[model samples]
Target: MRANKYEEVWTRIMFEKIEVLSNKTAITRTEMKQGVITLVKGLNAYFNKEISAQNDAEYINKVWNNFHLCEITMNLIGSLTPKELMEIFPIEKIYDGKKYQTKDWFSAHEAVQQLAQETPISESKEVFDFLWDYHNWDLHIFTVNVIASMNNINKMEKGRGLLEQFLEEQGVRTINKMDMIDVNWEEERDGE
Candidate 1:
């Protein structure tokens, strides 16, 4: 299964860090930004093409897997607030025809519902059109992916100490649950 852009970016960042550490070299800010931009561009291009095709069974399956992966990630990190969502996917940029007004609300769900009601998909043909436009979509995806990558990196750093402690307690060099099943199967077969 393929990971969402966030995870993909996070993995790329981690690998970059490892390379820097091994080489004892520092990465420039511009270099990091350029790398991220490249990755975002590539991902956006691939997703846009797949989404446009829409009828490819393999792409559809990948999309479903990506959806589930994103759902799990969101569950772990908690949902973004309505305000945050708006910041990432600004209504002004998305739809230029009519301004859709939204009010502040205590509940994120209610706020999202109000926003949805204000900008119904049926009324916003331009929304789909804008999304289909590669240049616009690429820029939007780049911004979102960058934000998600930073957020994931922060969260992973925060949890790193605990993960290390857990590994120490477990007395294992690495935790590979999938390999454990294979090991068990081999032992069972030997016994049989």
Candidate 2:
């Protein structure tokens, strides 16, 4: 899958695979819950030290947005059937100056109606499915193998591609379930 640049190939692969899965499952309540838990856990594990009690909510919300796409992905994996998945994932919470309410993730009719709205929608559910499935803990056994390989690498960026290749070679394509960890720094200090 060569391209004009390395990023193009990676992005294409990410988007195409995700789009297929997104079409399969739109969004539901259960998936939304799973996405929220995933976001909390991921932030806790990845950026725990950076957040304090005083700003936990704000930090978590920021992190959540960063992984909003991830939540969509997680929902796809947790709920296999689109219909079932839709029941699992909820529309995002929206606030209008005062109160907050859940918005619909699969608003086919409203989507059309709001097509010209100021805020454009990009099929996030699709992108989310890819990231979530790619890191699924149940179905993707290669996730285990990749975690083991992490022990030998100095940084995630340096090890991520190799781990993916190794897992692919071992016949692991979907990351439906897995978990593991290795020693890493609390932060990356530039010029180190």
Candidate 3:
């Protein structure tokens, strides 16, 4: 249940614009980033230790899922609806429709930690690796969006930036996803 680093960032960013949900003091992104980094580092450390003892694939997948949760969470930051956030996350809202019970995200994180600790290394390992890869893609998408949001870029700019950044990360000079029919990866991955 615990949110990954991206979720933490998204949560903080969402708080900055709490007005999107209701009238509340906007939070500073700087403050939010600080807290998120601390949380991620701590979680990473904890995972490293727990994973070391057991190599369960299922438990590892849960960890990866937890990490990917953070990446998908970045989509929740700028202007997405609470329902959209819920769809991406496994968490159910305790509060009506107004706000995301922040505590729920925390609780989810704890659940992931427990799964990581309790699940056997063999069963959980494959899931863990898959989740880890899935989360990487999630992070790539999230980073593009987060940077765009921070720069106050519009949707068009965000899309362009995403393609550019993705290419850069892949060490390619350029990438084109415009021709959906011709793009095999997008067809196979459903454009994620």
Candidate 4:
């Protein structure tokens, strides 16, 4: 399949998984836990099949890296409370007695950085190191978007079109295009 088609399939699968979790009338901790496990297993199998079919080493490497990243991320999602998830993945920009910096919206990257720094000899630090090394900001945004949908912070759409639309918006487009431009979040936050 073409890249776009692959993305469509993946997005549909993700939406289906999230729907199963979110459609519950009163989701218990056990249900959430089982849902997360199922999600991880499903994703692992899907990506493994995709990875095995690839011929290019570079493409395989990219998918492999992404798979591990998603694995770690889903584990984190399962462990965190709704309140904590909300704090890390706020749907809109937030004010903290100052201007709204990009960092304040979907701040999981920053949170992970802080966690990695604060706990040098812990599993969080290890996970943070791996994520930082293969850091794809788009993935971070997508994960937060998923969490927001699951928690009813945002309504789940049918496919990846909404996410692509979001990424194409002016502000987000600029952020996604930048390399070193906005990497220094602390300076950006201070200047804002």
Candidate 5:
């Protein structure tokens, strides 16, 4: 199918607006912006072709999921290290960990290429909430991985101590459980 120049231009602008609001990478903002633009162009092209032939739920879901992944990946790309990318993005270790530094953020440009052939997407608020969940999930995964990575499984406290030290060294604040309880905790929860 041929491209729609007008639609492409409009879609590009919409992606840019989303990036401004949802992208969190301070150091890699420009790179992220370029990445988002590329996604917009490529997705627009693919969807134009695919939409003409079919509109199956499976196909739609794939496109939708791919879109969500693209957004999440871009938002986290800066801090998603080479190692993390290879491992399907292991949760970032914030404290007692070496992976959460803002500078560690690098582009997941490769994923962009892969996802271009693929897609789900939703509201801006939904995207923000998805990212927030992923962030907290990463921290939880980091803690477990830290303990598991230890040579001696019996020495759990040692692993905990190491993580504690790492957390202290890095300025990533640990979210407290008690301080998280509120009227709208369930409605609009942050990290815990």
Candidate 6:
């Protein structure tokens, strides 16, 4: 599902997969909670300065989206259900008179509404697509793999498709039901 240029296919997979798993009753709240925690921890390990070196923009370009994908999965853990959030978001303007929120911020608010429901949303798929265009809510596993591989002429010759690439990335490989990290980031951080 790799697109030649500026094509999007990764986020769609994250949304659909997370939505289904989050809603499945058999998955259990315990399972969901554990899943989200593992993602956060693995991501932390990867981004931890002990594991990663201080590098330039080129390094960030390679690792940023995996960091991003980890974040999206964390958010996806929340998007599974509907809940209130009093986040001190930069885009929220201190609840004071200020400029409008960015399109990314606004789209995130829209995504909360769309994914929280039990049933399929009645809104346009385009709207979901638009709202999820942001990196926080998107898993760019495939897109980034294509990008990271472009420099490797041999791997490019191997022609790994999106799923193949996703499997190769740590972002997807590290996810499992091993240990739960606690999803209380919201309860404590957001004071929900």
List the global CA lDDT of all models: 0.40, 0.38, 0.39, 0.46, 0.40, 0.41
Q: Which tens-of-lDDT digit does each residue in 40-122 have in candidate 6? A: 33333333222243665555454555645554544544444433121211223222222554344455555555553453222
- Per-residue CA lDDT of candidate 2, range 64-95, in tens? 44345444544434334333332333223333
What is the TM-score of each predicted model, taking all chains together? 0.24, 0.20, 0.20, 0.26, 0.22, 0.30
Model 3: residue 110 alpha-carbon error in angstroms: 38
Candidate 5 steric clashes: 15
> Which parts of model 1 have CA positions greater than 4 angstroms off?
1-46, 49-64, 70-78, 93-192
2 or 5, greater by TM-score: 5
In terms of lDDT, the best-performing candidate is: 4
Cα deviation at 160, candidate 6, in Å, is 12
- How are the candidates ranked when ordered by TM-score, highest leading? 6, 4, 1, 5, 3, 2
Per residue, candidate 4 scores C-alpha lDDT tens digits across 2-26 of 8556656665665576677667777
Error of 2 at 96 (Å): 56
Model 2 earns a TM-score of: 0.20
Clashing pairs in 6: none
Better of 2 and 4 by TM-score: 4
Give lDDT for model 2: 0.38
Give the residue spans of candidate 5 off by over 4 A: 1-27, 51-192
| Colliding pairs, model 4 | none
**Candidate 6 deviant stretches above 4 angstroms:** 1-27, 47-79, 82-105, 119-192
User: Which digits, one per residue and each the tens of the lDDT, describe model 3 over residues 49-113?
Assistant: 23232455665454454454344333222222222222343344333322553334445344334
| lDDT by residue (tens digit), candidate 5, 87-174 | 4434344443235443122322322223312122121223333233343343333323323333222223343344445654675444
Q: After superposition, how far is residue 36 of candidate 1 from its true place, in Å?
A: 14
Clashes of 2: 23
